[model samples]
Target: MVFTIKKVINNNILCVTDAGGNEMIVTGRGIGFGHKAGQPVNSDAVQKIYHMASMPVQQKLMDLLEQIPYDHFLLTDELVSEIRKKIPYTLNEGLLITLADHISFAIKRKEQGVEFKNPLLESIREYYPEEYRMGKACVQRIQEKLSVDLSKDEAGFIALHIVNAELNTTMSITNDITRFVDGCVKVVESYYGRTFDHESLAFSRLAVHLRFFAQRLFQHEQESDDSMQDQDFRRLIASSCKEHYECAKKIAAYVAETWNQELTEEELLFLTIHLKRINLSSEQTTK
Candidate 1:
C-alpha cells in the first residue's frame, strides 16, 4: 500500500493516509527529507514504525496537548496528573500517546493560520452564544490555571475538550454526534431561556455538525463491527450525517438571529467540510 503524507513538522512527525484508509503517526528525522504534501511512502516503512519513550512530565504533556502538539518530547508527571485530575477523561497509554502526536501537528497548523469556515458566517453569534461565552471563559481559566501564557488557539483547544466531555461518554465520535446536537440545543436554550426558532435553525445546525465532524475526522474505530458491515451500516451513517448537517444548518441560521455577534471564519470552515461530507449523496459515509 502507498500512503501520501499531507503534513510534516520538524522533519520528524508526519500525517499520512494510505489507499486502504489508514492514517498514522510516524517519527524519524529523515522521514520528511524527500517528502512533499502529495508524496507517496512505502508500506514497509509504515510497518516498521517504532515506539518511543514517555516523559516524566506527561501531565504537563497533557496540558500541552490540550493546547498544542509535542511528539516524542519531554514532559512532567505532575503536569499530567494535574490535568488528569481536572478533566474526567480516562488517562491511558493510547490516549496519552495519540494526544501527544495530535497536539504537535495542531500547533504547527496554528502557526500556519489555517482558517476554519463557519456555516454560520452570516450570523454565528445568535446560533452559538454559549460557544462564544465558553471561548471567553476558557481564556480566563487558562490564565488562572496555567503558569505560562497561551494564545487564543490554545484557549480554543481547551474549549473543544470541554465540548467533547459534555457530549461523549467515550471518544467514539459516532455517539458524540448523536448526542452533540441534543447537547447544543439544551445549552443554547438554557442560555437564552428559549428554544430555537426556524430563522436561527440553519446556524444552529452548522454548530452541531462542526462539533461532530471535526472530532470524527481524526478518530478511527480500532476494530470493524462485523454487524455494521453485515447490515448496510454505511448507508445508515451517510443518511444520518446528512440529516445531522441539514438540521445543524437550520439551527445556525436560527442562532444568528438570536445572538448579535458575527461568526468567525474558522467556524465556517469546519461547518463547510461537514456539510460537504453529508452532501456527498450515496457515498459510503465511513471510509
Candidate 2:
C-alpha cells in the first residue's frame, strides 16, 4: 500500500506514474514541496484525481488523489466536467492541461480573498434571483446536455453565453455603439473649448474603446480595458456613469416604492454597472 513520488514540476502540476503503470495528473500546491522527481510523495499532499469509468484506472487514480488530505478549493473533475458541456472537443489533452493551470490560479486567487466587482450585480440579484437559476436554466435548455452538477463558475460561464447571444455582435451594431460615443462627445464638447468631430482623435479613440467595452459587457466579462485619461474618454465615462447612476437611483426608487425591497450595496453596484452599459447605445438592436 505504498507509493513513490514520480516527479514534481514547477508548473504546479504533477505527472506521476507509479507501481503498475498507473499515472495521475495531480495539482501542485502544498504538496511535496522542495522535492524533485523520484522524491517519495508524502501521503498528505494529493487532493483528488481525474476518475475514469474504467474501474482499475479509476481506483488507482482515486487512491492517488486521496493521498493528499487538505482540499484547496479546486476540483479538476468539476472544472473539466463543466467546460466539456460548452466545447464538446474540450476533452482533448490541450484543454485538460491548460484548464488545469487556469483552475489552479482561480482557486488560489479565491484562497487569497480576491474578489471581482461584478458588473451585473443587480441583474445577478433582482433579475436572475440566484446564480443557480440562470445556470440551471441554461443547463436545462442545453443543445448538448451534460449530466454533471455544474459548478457556480460553470453556471456563470453559461449565463454569459446567454447574454452574448442576446446582444448582437457586428459592425452595424458597433455603429450603434458609436451613437453613445456621439452623445459622450457632445457632452465633452459642451464642457471644453476644444472642438473636434467624432472622426477626430479624441472621439475615435474612445469609440474604439467603447466598441471593445460593449463586446466584453455582452460576453459578461465585466473586467475589460476601458480607461479614462484623455479628456474625451473621461467625458465619455462621466456621461455614461452619470446616466447609469441616475438609472440606478431610479431603480432603487422603484424597488423601494413598488417592490418594497431595500437594495443592498451589492445589488445597487451591478445595477448601475449594467444600466450604464445597456444605455451605451449598441447596434445590438439589429441582428
TM-score winner among the candidates? Answer: 1
The 10-residue segment with the lowest total lDDT in model 2: 122-131
Residue range 14-104, candidate 1, lDDT tens digits: 6666677555455444666767888887655542332223433333433443344232232222233344565554544434443344344
- The TM-score obtained by model 1 is 0.29
lDDT of 2 by residue, 95-214 (tens): 333333333444455557663443433232222233235455543433133333334554453333333223434423433333433433344434333444433343344444444444
Instruction: Give candidate 2's error at residue 158 in angstroms.
Output: 4.6
- Give lDDT per model, in order: 0.44, 0.43
**Clash number for every model?**
50, 3
Best by lDDT: 1
Predict model 1's lDDT versus the native: 0.44
Question: Which parts of model 2 have CA positions greater than 4 angstroms off?
Answer: 10-13, 27-29, 42-45, 51-287
